[model samples]
Target chain A: MAINWFKYSSPASFYSLAGKMIPLFAAAAVILLIMGLYIGFFIAPTDFQQGEAYRIIFIHVPAAWMSMFLYVVMACWAGFGLAFNTRLSSMMATAIAPTGAMFTFLALWTGSLWGKPMWGTWWVWDARLTSELILLFLYIGFMSLQAAIDDPRRADKAGAIIALVGVVNIPIIYFSVQWWNTLHQGASVSVNQAPAMASTMLMGMLIMVFASWMYSIAVILKRVRIIILERESHTTWVAELQKDGVA
Target chain B: MKPRHKKLAMIVAGVAALGVASVLVLDAFQSNLVFFFTPTQVAAKEVPIGKSFRIGGLVTEGSVQREDTSTTVYFSVTDTSHTIPVVYTGILPDLFKEGKGVVAQGKMSDRGIFKADEVLAKHDENYMPPEAAEALERAAKAQKASLSE
Candidate 1:
């Protein structure tokens, strides 16, 4: 017997399912956050070069990673929505934008904080930095373009086009150091080489990365549930949920 | 194929075409996208004379110099294959040490020197505790001594 995975593609069912799953993800996020913070601040040793100032990587690296990862995820959802004309897929894509933008902003902010002391400047127009900045702009562009359109279907289609087009920048950002003589350092944790970092520092960074992932999933799920309720407000199921005070 | 399948195929084709277009575009704009030039690039006279640019590489070991009473500092950046002399007047960043990565933005002077307006430390991705770093240094020293003996 095969399970029908498409059943949850319905907004009414997904909304309730999301509501049920939110607390679990939220709890995992909180737990991982605490553990990650403890490892980052307490267990990790001072950097031999940057000293304690380098501890900011715990937040900076994870936020940067999440920003790029979330954009790909958002674009994929938007593309699927556009291709299949699925209402739930479009709503999910819409719900992911704000969170993706938030992570992008966080990545930029935390990066500057790390850069000011280590690089002797708060900002530079290096290839990696510029590409990442363009990513932030792309996220904003997607959201604003969608909001500018009054019709939800048209907004989804337009956003999907922009999202798919912007996917090229993702590879550019990831490979900027290798492709050019960039001011930004190459990745510490790339697949082709052994990590350039110590084991403990690497562990802390990885833990924080997992924490960010959990946090993003929880927040996106909660946001999608609200979006579902708003989009399906006229449906009988939503009306019953509102009447029963379960919404 | 169904209408949905047709739509999916269309989107995939559009995305693939867009990807190929972007690759070509990026290739054409590759030179402009480079943040800095290496010492090898600059040494080959490929860089335009009298034009300001950035050169990034490792700060040559034992090449740093500073005046006792002046703010001016001199250093050499090397990519192992080539080296470029750099001069700056501002205070250096804390991480700007000899044998470390650096990027200096400036123009080549008439006397073949890089007059930097801004100097920034370009650190590697390595992050280790001081103890681990000291251990590595000690091991390197030991290997050097054995080789000499």
Candidate 2:
């Protein structure tokens, strides 16, 4: 069966498709969160050094990964919208920003809590930390720039430019610990090396990562539906849908 | 503005922003990027005397000593080619042990001893932190480069 994927690319069609997907993704997210947290807090062995405090890595590493990954995804969507002038792509970019920012904030806050016990300070100006702080600023800058402009098209173009430029910071953040003498420790899990933690810990962390991924997708879909309504409020189809209580 | 002009404006704006960002990145990398110095750098007089900095490497075997006073501890950090004695007055992190990775932040005395205000052990025993491992590799590379010269 051939499905015309392009049909769903339109905002009106995507709104319904997203509505159908939200509940499934949201359910999976909830289930995975429960399982991941259970395994993370219960099944994973206590560290030989960091003790129970090291358990924070279950949430911290996943949130950190999502923060970086979501930014790249946002930039790609924004770039697509800029190049193709697709309204839905730009709407997706806007929908994703807040979720990405939330994850970034979570990563930093959890990292500070983890640091207080291990590093003896709540924060330090290490290269990794500083670059991550810059990432947070970039997110805020993108949102603020988008909001400041009254025209939606102008806002999308401007926000896209900022998001694209900010992509450079992603590599810097990942490589900061390796490139500089930083107080922040290096990653335990790398492509070329075996993960330093036990198998159970790795499993739990991976599950948590997927949970966060699904959660973001669900939330972004819901937000994008609202954005569609806001942008197309004056259109006949949108008005009909709202009148029929379909929206 | 026409649609064509809008595209041009976006292109120009993106290019300008990227150019500015690249300059900031370069400046940050050059000035604020602190490279880890191995014991070799300390021995070769490469590190500054008065300025506080971090030294990272494996704790030399049989070098950790605890005074009866319990607050002060002594150890030597090494990258195999050289070793620098570190004097720290604090409780050591759980992973601090002989033949393990450590980073000590403090100033160095004229007599070659590191007076550490803080001592940090690596996250695990078997696994060296990537930053510390990379520092060792860099120091070794520099040594090889000098030998070839």
Candidate 3:
């Protein structure tokens, strides 16, 4: 039998399904994070140069990657919602925004912590950092713009516009190091070139990245279910579910 | 046209307009976006005098100089194509070393010396910053071609 994936596009169906998956992903995220941190700290050799301080890359790089990746995913969902007028897609976009912003802030904070010991400064107006900062603003703007609107549909439309507009910054952030003479170091792990890191370090970083990915999905799914309940509260199904004490 | 078509058209137009506007804004900010200049660019006098900027490259081999009691130190940064002498008065990061990548933030003097306010070393030992690595690769290729000829 084929799985009717499209059926879950409706908010009600996805709400229950995501509720089932959240615990699994949350557990995976926690386990992977612990393993990644352990491997990063204990198993990875001290950088002949940076010593133990380089281990911050395990968290910093993953957070930065997720920030950028989530923005694109958010924009894609927002765009889909705008085009198809789907409530669930808009909810997904909204749900992902706060998490994306959190990761972006984490990336910046960890970068500053790493920088102080290594780069000798807490912060600089480097292209990568600046664009990432702008991304934080975009997320805040999207959420605030939505909150300011009373009607859910209007808020979604407005949020979609902001999300689409901010999509330009994603490429800027990714390519900033390459396009500018930024103090920020270039990527160690890239697609075309071999990783400029030890295998164990690379493995740990990858695991952390996966862990962050799982965490984002689980959190966003949980948030979207709440969004659906709030927006669909007036519907008969929601009332019936509430009466049954399951909503 | 239908109401849905009208909304779709509005979004398309709006995104297009926003895209064009951002492109213009970013183009205006292009020069300012350069995080640092290479030693080669400094040598070519592309950098302005007394204007603070950053220069990034490898610390040229055996070029670090330090005073006996003073915190002042001098080093030369190189991309193999050109080198800029940098004078800085402070403790350098632990990673700062000869033959390693570095970026110094300062100004170029009229006499061609760089007065550095801050000296930052690259991230790690195994990591040659992408810009520094790219420059080295270019220099190596040039050397190979010259030797072959």
Candidate 4:
């Protein structure tokens, strides 16, 4: 029999469900982080050209990927909220912003560290780099706009509009290396060609990517639960949960 | 505002937002999206004269010359169709080797030479281990030797 898919779409149900999943995801994230870092540092051999400094890719590339990926996910959730007037969808979108921004900041930070010795500068106005910086700003803008609006419903709509608009930057950031003569390099991994990285290096990077994904999911779920509690505080269901000391 | 009227207004606003978003993405792609100009663009005078601009291309083989007493170095950057000689009086990046990609930021001198204040290495996507890199190099040498023989 088909299950009712919308059961958890309600904030009240999703709250406890999210709590149950967060611990599992958080545990997975921690385990994967350790394995990824171990393999990244100990198992992966030194690069022929970049030497030991290239190990930073384990963090940089995965963080960069997640920064973009989370933005898309946020936009999709925000879009669903705008279209269907789903309160849970909007809350999820809002919950995702800080984590996505954090990842974006991490990506830029690690990238500069890697670029300094390899590319000879901490930063440049390259299309890829600038577009990424724009992503960070977009996340900040999304959060700030939401915070500024007193009405949560109106804030969701405004944030959703901006999120949808800023989705265009994702493609520009991904293809900036190809579309322009940017100082940034092209992608190391692509679907059209065999990955250029050594197998062990690729493994470490993939593990780190999964780790980032799990961490983002766990944090977003936790944040969404708190958001539900805050927004539905006046509701009878929330009052019952709070009375029981579970909220 | 009435609930019905507010709902209608929200729908209108959402539609407007979608329109603006589409227009923005289209404009972003269609506009001059170049981050740096190539040697061909520089040769064609597409780059403005005397204004500081970036030029990106492969560092021409066997063209790097270093001054012993100073940090100044001269090299030619080429996109195969055209070339620009660049003079920089600063430290080069680790990846700034002959036949490798580079981007230099500076303006043209009175004699049409590029005097760069900064240089950056443009790396490729390849990220193999040292063993694999050496193996590839050895294979390339063998192929070249066979071609010569």
The lDDT of each candidate is 0.90, 0.88, 0.89, 0.93
Per-residue error for B68 in candidate 3, Å, reads 1.8
Which runs in model 2 stand beyond 4 Å of their true positions? B1-35, B124-149
The two-chain DockQ for each candidate, comma-separated, is 0.65, 0.17, 0.31, 0.59
**In model 2 chain A, which range of ten residues has the least summed lDDT?**
A43-52
Best by DockQ: 1
Summarize candidate 4's per-residue lDDT along A1-247 as a digit string, tens digits: 9977789999998998998999999999999999999999999999887889899999999999999999999999999999999999999999999999999999999999999999999998778999999999999999999999999999999999999999999998998888776778888898898888889999999999999999999999999999999999999999999789963
> On residues B1-149, what C-alpha lDDT tens digit does candidate 2 reach at each position?
99999999999999999999989978877763464678987888777779998888989999989999678999999999999999999877766778877888999987779999988764542233345456777999999999999
Could you tell me which residue pairs clash in candidate 4? none
lDDT of 2 by residue, A1-247 (tens): 9999999999999999999999999999999999999999998777655668888988999999999999999999999999999999999999999999999999999999987777666787777888998999999999999999999999999999999999999998999877787777888888998887667788899999999999999999999999999999999989899779863
What TM-score does candidate 3 get on C-alpha atoms? Answer: 0.85
Badly placed stretches (over 4 Å) of model 3 are B1-33, B124-149
For the candidates in turn, chain A alone yields TM-scores of 0.97, 0.98, 0.98, 0.98
- Name the regions of candidate 1 deviating beyond 4 angstroms: A1-4, B1-33
Which of 1 and 4 is the better model by TM-score?
1
Candidate 1 lDDT by residue in tens digits, A1-247: 9977788988887888899998988898899899989999999999999999999999999999999999999999999999999988888788898988998899899889888899999999988889999999999999999999988789989999999999989998998888877888889998889999999999989988998888888999999988888777889998999889963
Ranking by DockQ: 1, 4, 3, 2
Candidate 1 lDDT (Cα, 0 to 1):
0.90
